[model samples]
Target: MDTQQNTALTRALAEIPGPLPARGVIHIAIPHTDRFTVVGNHLAQHPDLSCTAVGIAVRIQSLPQGVEVGIKALAARCREGEKRIAAALRELEAFGYLQRVRDRLPSGRTITRTVFCNQPTALLRPRQTASPRRPAVAATHQAPGPAPGPGPAEELTAAPAPAPDPAPDPAPTPPSPSPSPSPSPEPDMPEPPPVPPPPSFVTPLPPLFVPLVPPPTAPKPPPPPLPRPAEPTPELDRAATALLSDLRHHAPQFTLSEADIRHLAPGVAAWLERAAHPDAIRRTLTTDLPHPLRRPALLLKHRLTALLPPPLPGVHDLAAPARPRVTVTPFQTCDGCDRVFRSPTPGHCRDCREHRAHRAHRGDDTRTAAA
Candidate 1:
């Protein structure tokens, strides 16, 4: 495959987000092609194969290329018994979905590695037998090539004499007499009437089709346009890529994609447009990160978003809410009514406030009652 097509296919396959590092996207993702699907489907639906076997084959196919998945590992991953996994592996191998190769390590240790070809191919498998050889051509004996010259004649040539013939005839004998004819039988009393022909059968009408339930049909939508992978500006690409690379260096286990970088490019671009130093942005993103982060891209994105500067000050719109002004004020608590109020005059609350008129009225009322 050409570079562009292969890259696009890889990205599409990688879209299936994997479990561990990614959806089996290590440094590169395995291309999911028809061949892979065919092998998986064969194992899944073949009557002789059990569901456990199908599940094992499918999970192995799901793994990325270069993954070291052994029978034990597979059993653990699939939650199947080790023996079951071994049997499934054998079945897969027998069915051509798997192949085992013995590779000798540098230390001379030979270990068997599996190669899986999921295509439904009819391979010309060879056998140990002698090849039938071609038949030997029959030898042709040429009749003695025409005698040199006609030769060899007899001594005398005498004319042969003819012989005469003689014969005679005889008389005939009388024929024997014929027997007399027998009497004829009497005719039947009355002849029977001829039988009428049967009536012709009419053609039958075809049966009208009636279904138990209406066939379900869904409205089909117009075909969606083929995906055109976005091409980001070179500078944005470099910045985003560099950030992801640095993060990887900090945390090796972290998995990130070019798509993720492109997705976060706008935020990075926003920071860049606001005259934020690229170094400052990088420093802010990489700073104070947890040791083992589940998703580094998410954390980086959040930091970049927080670091983004707001648009420069502009003339306020009339419809927009105005910004409130701020002024410092002292708070004091009223002695009579233990209520705190912010103001210049704050002896007490107005209702429980200290006033001269109410005190005199209270004293006169008390004195009148006493007299």
Candidate 2:
């Protein structure tokens, strides 16, 4: 490989993100025409060989053709005078550009492979088609060429053309008439007999009284008793106590009163003990407490009470507020009298305003005299 080209290729490969894998680097050096040409061209333009060195190193390790150089050999070749070849190799390996393949015998030497660390080039176009004219020429030469035919005009007149036939006219056709037939008398059939009506009853029947009976009553099912949760054990109480104590003692800026600690100690201790033995702690805290007290007790002891901090003094008891800050607005100072006024309007300060008015009055007197 051309050293400069190879170096440039290496630099280009390094510019590409990711380390070159050993197998991949060996594959790059496998003398594939397209890859070799692409890599060679890339190296020609940019010769920083860090990427190439990594790839070369990887290839040298894995492939039979590789020099089987240890880290020292690679460093001597690529990073001469550098502190450590192993360090450079490690950096390359981290980049995914170099990989160790095997160690050399007895010398504690390592072989590494360098591979191109790049995304595969997606070919945008397929190879061009072979020329058709060459194949045609070959075919014609192999078998003798066909005999030359007559010129265009002679070939056209060689066969006499047939005469054209006359066209027929299209017209709608009239409908054909049907044959007449004689009428005949139809035979009559007998009608069905009518149904007879029932005779009316003269005597009235006595009214019947039916007695009402009540439906059999079903026994109502007894209301299902409410489900009661299992009671919490002593271990849960101890674990809870220890956890709360730890929180109060170790947490920043937190203080618990003696009364509050005493009230909560049993539960906290139970909680800690249970935490040490998780299997013993009840799944639900409300399981042990009476139904009426369960919710209120949890709210007061666990959540609301634990979060309470020592009372702070009211805002009114603090020191009085400081005066609001004020910024001085810049104003123009009179050049003639040194009087400052809050106006940026040009020539309008007290001195300049009076000076301009006097000049105008003088000019008016001069005009009056001239008139």
Candidate 3:
């Protein structure tokens, strides 16, 4: 009974044929009401970010505050090793999704602070050069000068001539010699020289908003055109189309529809016009068909276009030295039969010559008989 059941199962499996269809990722989303962390599409769908980096980012965002999220900590929590975790963290930092800063505490200990941003674009920080201290200007000091002496007017008021005696003195008092003028105050110290402004030390800052994606580079050059025959004709086109349609008969793998045949006909026509044999074209299109062949017309079109042969060579293309032209034989009339024939010089026709030879042989026979 077990043997019979096994045979039945084998037969059932044999009935199913052909390759299985390719499977692709399919999302079966279930909306979460609570205990879910909201992640922006910028980090989730970043083109440059790797899958590991995105996963690490999501995990870091979901965790509560005060949790150790360093490389070793993450490696312990997740299956990845420390090296991969560190690499992912670097990727996150580069794209502005995460930032790690070494902060110093009041107690003189330094610790790393990891900052995760859900929306890097909205909270993106601009990169700026550090601000340097401005240069100091030296102070200018001038030597002090002597103070100005009392002016002539102040001296007159300060020492009023001994008040004139109420009664006129009998003898004029010898006029006191006028006090010598006080020495002129020394020249005012020369004004101090002006000081120049300090040189600018602060570097100019780049644009405030940092782009999450790197700046675009120049576009690449377009590819060269595909090979093809120089000139095409209606007959060539028809023949090419027929060949393409008939491909399915010889090789079932290249079963193309009418639309595909029409589309690929021009490329085939190019191959045909280049003197490629029909059998060669068929073999080329059918040879080594890929297993589970899909889009046979596309494959045939590519081969036809890319593998087209060069045009047949002309007489001038020969490598040998040029040869002299052969002289044409002129038409001639046979001397005996007057039949027209071509020859370099006048001569009897072939039939007339053969008749003469036969008559000469018969005469010799007659002569021998008579003797």
Candidate 4:
């Protein structure tokens, strides 16, 4: 087998954000097990979760610890669709293999975090009646950041309570200097070099070009979908009718509406266009079909689509046409020594011509007997 080149895997590995210098790698023992022995075998007992979900769960659990990742990224890594990833995540969470928490930061940004907890589900837990085993899993919680303003002790002494009422000032109060408090420091700061104005003669060009014509102020509504092929073309309609006729002949009990036949016609017409025999398609639809078909027309459509034949040899390649059979040519045999020759008059072959020459030579040599 050719070596597997995981370009997607390599790209994902390259995309993993590196750890900060302040943080070092920490190893936490992750529960690892054969899916067939544990997950697949057990999940198989319940049909709803299907065998596929087990593999998807395993892919999610395979990510490294402490990597902040997104569902899209996980979907890409697992080569699964987003919906499938989401469903698998839900399934794992339901089974106790995952936990999700949503948190809001002080800045009002909300973030969702996922933890892969491989703890066994209650159904998978071993049952022992004797004595309860000490719970292996301990609840984990993050230490809360120091609560906002001040400690209870500091609140008493932090600041004296503001005066209950202040007399109205007659004049507009001067702006407080407390916020800046560093006018002297400003004097010590270095100044920027002044830019000289453009030479007086130079006229500035009109502000570049007028602000690019802002895209049409209003958005254009999406174009309506192309009208569906005018409900099947004439050829398709004809093919559909022909199919119904054939079905009626084979199984007089079968009945189908024009719409149903038209719906299936596209596939049947496609088969004919590809040079599939109409009789074969008809037989497929009408013959020893399964006993309890829910929708025969739809089933026949699927079969036609799936069983499309490979292109015929001359369907393409018109330059070189095929012959049904080899052409025959007439030939005659020599009377002297029955050998076939293309020249009918000189029937004898080249060898027979040489034999005649030898016979003439033999007669010439018998001088006394016949000369």
Candidate 5:
């Protein structure tokens, strides 16, 4: 990573508070991977807490809770031995990088579980500098020089004072009013009539009521149609054919059974014809056979003899005497039936018999249903 990326990562890690130590030991341990080494080297170069490089790495990596690893594993990938690794780890511990927890394995091995040091360290700032103080100089005793300018009392008395104002005179006043008016004469235009007050009563009208009408009902939505079963696509059929063909080529045993070959008669016949014409089947089968089975062709020829119905009229048995019986010891027991059986058996004999019986029972049920 570049310097900027490293610096950013370091800053981010520093921002994450480390874990508090429990029982005086850090429990979080960061593996000594390349990432951890890079972080450690960066911490050594920066103004970071001394002991926290590994702890920060662990936290940044988001290691699982309670995960612990061996110091031997940590030191194995380092140039330094156990001592130096321990010292570096201790420095980190002291710096509050990780909280170490002591753990004992079932194998009687002791290990430390170091957790991320999430607890923050006290950050100290630089102190301010004090200003220098000036020393007070002593004045020489000056003689009572010729009387100084003014006396202190004279200076106070020289200030100005204020004046006072005069008073004014009063004046005179006046009188009051009388009582009722005398009657006057009436004019020829005389007595225009007085108007009457307007009427206060109003007529009450009957309320006109209209009946409420209900809104028209909306049509019900059609029920969602049932989902149709999916039909197989041509692509799917082609893909299945290709997959089966590949399986026949690579894992022929699965497809070479008599029942399977009968269902795939045409294909099997073509394949066998090709095999026989070019001798490819024989060569391939011989190469794939296990070492024990690959003896001289004569052994196969002898085995095939029993497969034939009978020998030609004049053809005599030109085979040598049979080899002595090889006593094969049984090594395994059938897990299903708990019966001891030979190693070369295809499967557990009793279990196989039971399985065959179960299959036959199922077949019988199927036949009955058909009937």
Candidate 6:
């Protein structure tokens, strides 16, 4: 019944499908005449090995003899990184597909030799024993040569046959002895009672009581002070380097190598960044000459770092506050009211002036009315 059902299912699948969804890899193998390697199915379809490991194994098998199959070499050839390649190699080694043996050569140089196995299971098979050889008489017998004369057949028949009549003698059997009676079974003894487990001797301690107050923690050492933000650009560095190199021309004691100039360029660059003049830097670096001047670089580094001028202050920081201007007018007494007031020149105060103008207007009005 199961076979019938399977047949019906197969027919249905065949009739309804254009092409079934690809469930797994479909291989299109072309036989190779030239550069093909024979890889065992055990390694190609290994259940324990990952895809990467299987690929690496296949590649190693196909490579020509003496070609490097180390992790670095494989990594360089393949797109996978060194770490993944190494991992795949480890997997191959674990599954018996690869083995690395460290051998010391006669020249005392140690090298790692890798062995790739196609059929891993073959490594586990035991060696077969050799078959026994035939007896000496049979081994010595040779085939008959060509007939020597007309009576060759009669001569062959007359030749003595190789002796083979020895037979081995059988050993004599010993006479049968009378059987002894079986010993009686011993009486059963009572089993011992089970022993009680030993009691634990350790005493239980009371729970520890912690204080409510938190213990004082040591203050974190102040975060390391930040390095000065030295803005060393390409231009600044180049200028600084030139200045350092020229120091030897000005002072023979300050002769520095190319390495020293490169190392100390950044330090001198920091001084230039702080609005320090190039002349000032040259003077500072070359002014004081130690008699011996064991290390000119060290001296320059110390001066550059220690005596780096602070950045020039901004306008606000440098400029003093200006006092407001005040004009001092001369003090005057009003002519009409005699009230003291401040004025550019002696004159009546505002109240007195208004009163005099009022009086003059009133007099003008009376004179016009009379006319």
Highest-scoring model, TM-score: 3
Ranking by lDDT: 3, 6, 1, 4, 2, 5
- Model 3 lDDT per residue over 1-371, tens place: 44546776565555556543468643335579999998888888888788999999999999999899999999999999999898888777777777777799999999989877777665434445445544554435446689999998998789556675588558867899999999865655565555555555555454333334342232566643544446877898889889988988999887788888877887888788778899999988899888888788768867776677778887788668779999888899999888999987897999988999999999999999999
**Predictions in order: lDDT:** 0.63, 0.47, 0.78, 0.62, 0.46, 0.76
Q: Model 3: residues >4 Å from true position, as ranges?
A: 1-42, 47-228, 320-371
What tens digits encode model 2's per-residue C-alpha lDDT throughout 84-195?
Answer: 5554445444433344444576788765454433311222223343433322222212334798889999988898788978878758678767766655434444444543
Q: What TM-score would you give candidate 5 relative to the actual structure?
A: 0.17
Candidate 4 shows a clash count of 0
Checking candidate 3 for backbone clashes, the offending pairs are none
Candidate 1 lDDT, tens digit per residue, 239-312? 75676656656556445787887677666766665556777777777777796777877776667655566555
The alpha-carbon lDDT assigned to residue 354 of candidate 3 equals 94
Off by over 4 Å in 5: 1-67, 102-112, 122-371
Model 5 per-residue lDDT tens digits across residues 191-231: 43444444434444332211122112224666433121134
How high is each candidate's TM-score? 0.23, 0.18, 0.36, 0.27, 0.17, 0.30
Write down the worst ten-residue block by lDDT for model 6: 207-216
Q: Candidate 1 — which residues are off by over 4 angstroms?
A: 1-40, 120-122, 125-371
Order of all candidates by TM-score, from best down to worst? 3, 6, 4, 1, 2, 5
> After superposing candidate 6, which stretches have Cα over 4 Å from the reference?
1-29, 132-371
Candidate 4 lDDT over residue span 53-155, tens digit each: 6676666555567764456887667677888777666665665556677899999999888766444454344444344334444334445487798879999
> For model 6, how does the per-residue alpha-carbon lDDT over 1-371 read when each residue is reduced to its tens digit?
44446676566667653676679753434468987778877887777677888889889988988999998899889988998888788777666677788899999999999888777666565545444544333223345588777587788779688998898986888987979888865555555555554544544433222223221232456533212336657888888889999998889888898888887887777777777788898999898678888988878777777777888899999899998999899899988889999999998999988989999999999999999
Candidate 6 to native Cα RMSD, angstroms: 36.3
Q: What value does the lDDT take at residue 23 in candidate 2?
A: 75
**lDDT of predicted model 3:** 0.78
